[model samples]
Target: MSQNRRDPEQVVAAARKGAAEAQRQQIEIIKQFAAIDCGTGDEEGNARVVEIIDRQLKLIKGIEITHHYAEGYGIHIVARLKPEKPEGKILLSAHTDTVFHRGDTAAYPYHEDGDTAYGLGIVDCKGGILVAIHAVRIMQEADMLPNKEIVFIFNCDEETGTPNGHAVFDTEIPGAEMAFVFEPSRDEDGVLTARKGACSITVEVFGKKAHSGVNYLDGRSATVELGHMLVRLYENNDNVRGIQFNPAALYGGDYGTGIVSDHATAKVGVRVACQADIDKVKEIIARVEKETYIEGTKTEIRIDRISVPMERNEKNVQLYETVHKAGLLLGKDLPEQASGGSGDASYFSYRGVPAVDALGPYMYKIHSTDESMRLSSFEEKTALFAVVLGIL
Candidate 1:
């Protein structure tokens, strides 16, 4: 039997209503959160929001939000939507924390300009969080929620590479069968099916500190040693093969004081398309760790595997199929895309659960001071989300 085609007029109307409701609901939540500055290690900020959401959850049936704390600066919020009867589980993941320093949002809150909103974390992820909430609300109103269980994960720390967040998730929801990450989509009409593996690493060099003029020969410069390692790391960059290693932050001695540096630090961000390539590059990092530039200076390496690549698979094909059919019913088409940026979808897909990211609306200038999500894409994405849930 052919699925009944949905009228674009009616669908758009429903989407418009849904979007308006969502925006209103979202704005309220944002205002509440914006009142409190939710930076990493801000327990009070996280607790305030979690407590509010929990109280609201008590009134809603089959929905529960749990809070878990990871080691320093790590928190995970798991929102579970379970139907009366059991079905497959679907995970919708988004991070709540922003890259901005503490009190940034409090100082510069959300502001609107025609159709766009600008704020510290507005586009990077808070918009995605609001989208998930509104989508779920629509699902409840339509009474079309599937027998399948839906879980919305609001990770506390994603901008910091989810060191503790990933561990908490792996321990909590090991049974999830599928996941959709509400990360900011790329440009317009962008959807993500694949992402590169990511790593967070710190390079520290130690050297003797001495006065520049009196004991210049007595001190080895750690900053110079760090530069050598950085130069070597850059030589292997290959844009064609999707391999890029960048030095995100570097700190060294005080230059104006004329003191030879005794310590230096550098943080590196590595992205790789394939697991084999990621493993291959570790040799280069290891080589740098072993070699020393300055005499009597030593270097220490702290390499961490934050998240792995989500390779394309058959399960992803099935998900795209369902999403595509739902789009057709609504007279829209959402193309499958492979993304290079890393997201929580990488965590689920790497663990064998098929996942798709960039499921939210089109967002621009993410992680910037002028970030914004398109006004139209909000309704479009929510409608698509509701339709997909009903179909499943």
Candidate 2:
């Protein structure tokens, strides 16, 4: 039963069968995963997740598992499965960390009601992790696994933009033909063809402090300067299509109401569609920084944790078409859409790896207590992923 001699329809049918058989077990696995609180920077919790995944991957016989750890970030696991007959290389990635806190899971554990499963990070990525793992397992059990070198990465820090796991991707992404990121599909089961680039900009304004009543005219208020800057920053949002500047958090002034504030700080979240958009954002930030709402006030800006956009390119569209064909095989129409959210997919797609995202379950309200994934989508997406791997 050589791969070339096998019928594509038969392979897809086998994937669907395997997916159906594993549906219940997959749900249980997600429950197990959701019980652990692997929030970003929770080293112990994230390590526990790594151990679970590592132990499971070891049972599969030929997977070469490597654990990468950074000082502040938890472990990142890279599991490679090389086929007997290698056709090409494929990369699969999912994040282990969520945006919730350590006790959030204890307060809101995984629960299933009818066809929806709810938890803190269940859909945001725990479900996605199961999809990546079980999709490979289903293909293997069906004897329909493709003759491609499969590299799967379960990263620990995606909610914070993968500052630690980017190093692993830097090494693993090259030479890979296509990448699938398990980042939970849109509520309507839409896969992401494009995602906005993101960065955090922190602005600090400094001015001289003085008594508000006695030295009102002489004193420069940093708080007033930051207030003006925030308004200008918000104006950048939608100024150009697909570009946004959000002043997410602001801190300024002491509790003393009688004193003019000497310092103010603003944390802005910037999202852009392309390099040109990023450049435009920088220009706007500079303009805001230079304008003086209050005399003698100086501003300093720091931009860090930048992630590039996942552009909708031809290769990405081709990969989406492959997934779409797989969906049709399962009698599902998985629409392709663009997302303002950023993920690990952007890393590969930005580097020309032909990446597609949201290959995970169909879920909504991720990063919140209302986070839930459709129970049926687990089987459906797993089957779709397995079929895509087989046909590729």
Alpha-carbon TM-score of each model against the true structure: 0.86, 0.96
* TM-score leader: 2
Q: Which stretches in model 2 have alpha-carbon errors above 4 Å?
A: 1-4
Residue-level error in angstroms, candidate 1, position 51:
3.9
Q: Summing lDDT over every window of 10 consecutive residues in candidate 1, give the lowest-scoring window.
A: 1-10
Q: Write the per-residue lDDT of candidate 1 for residues 62-147, one digit (tens) a residue.
A: 68877787656645788788876656788888887766666677677777687676666655676677677677777676555667
Candidate 1 ranges beyond 4 A from true positions = 1-21, 55-60, 208-215, 254-262, 291-296
Range of the 10 consecutive residues with the lowest summed lDDT in candidate 2: 1-10
Of the candidates shown, which would achieve the greatest lDDT relative to the real structure? 2
lDDT of 1 at 381: 74
CA lDDT of each prediction against the hidden true structure: 0.73, 0.85
| Model 2: residue 1 alpha-carbon error in angstroms | 10
User: What is the per-residue lDDT of model 2 for residues 1-392, given as tens digits with 9 covering 90 to 100?
Assistant: 34466687887888889889878887877888888887899999988888778876765558999888887878889999997778788999998888988788889988889999988888889888888888888788777777789999988888888887888998987789999999998857888889998988998999889888998777788898988888877876875486777887888888477988989998988888888887887888888889887779998877866888898899999999999988887788889999988888999998889999998998878878889989998988889898887777
